[model samples]
Target: MGLFVHGDVGTAASYEPPYTLSSGESVRGGERRLWDNGAACGRRYRLRCLSGSNRPCKDGTVDVTVVDYCRKSPCPSTILLSTSAFSAISKSPSAKINAEYIQ
Candidate 1:
């Protein structure tokens, strides 16, 4: 349900989180990040990742700040996240997860 945002893999030396969402809202470093099905940006939501049958989940719940949109064209995926944000809540970045969202 979540994937790391492009150019945000691992930790960077500069380590600058996106300051402005595509929808024109301010964001900060180290804040939780998420993307949604509607490709909506600049929205905030509470996300809960359920533990899988095969793999255990980490940090099952998180408050996410939406700073970008996930597009279906070109590269298809949903819920792009910053590396740090994904790491905090999920055990592996590549895991397929069942998640709940609350605004």
Candidate 2:
């Protein structure tokens, strides 16, 4: 599905994840489908960029924790990856790209 890359910080975690996140570990915010009524908090996923017209796919995947829920109007994408997570799997930083992910 389409991906949204967050800036320096992630969106608010509705449930307030219980565990401590490792320093430098990437995180993400999810749309409702992934939110699962806040149960998604602290869930981790492995994401890889899908090849697109602009060749936006990178060579590897990024593993990230679900730190929050995406609160954007219309909920722009399936998940919001942190900037570091996005850069690890995508060649184009600002372009919307499809992705393959496993939880």
Among all candidates shown, the one with the greatest TM-score = 2
Q: Which parts of model 2 are misplaced by more than 4 Å?
A: 1-24
Q: For candidate 2, lDDT tens digit of each residue in 1-103? A: 3353542222211122343466544454556877788888877777776655578777876778876666676665676766666778776666566766677
TM-score of each: 0.51, 0.72
**For each candidate, how many residue pairs have backbone atoms clashing (under 3 Å)?**
0, 0
In angstroms, the error of model 1 at 36 is 9.2
RMSD of 2: 8.6
- Using lDDT as the measure, the top candidate is 2
RMSD of each: 10.4, 8.6
Please estimate how well model 1 matches the true structure, expressed as its whole-model Cα lDDT: 0.44
Error of 1 at 76 (Å): 4.5
Error (Å) of candidate 1 at residue 88 is 1.7
User: Which pairs clash (backbone N, Cα, C closer than 3 Å) in model 2?
Assistant: none
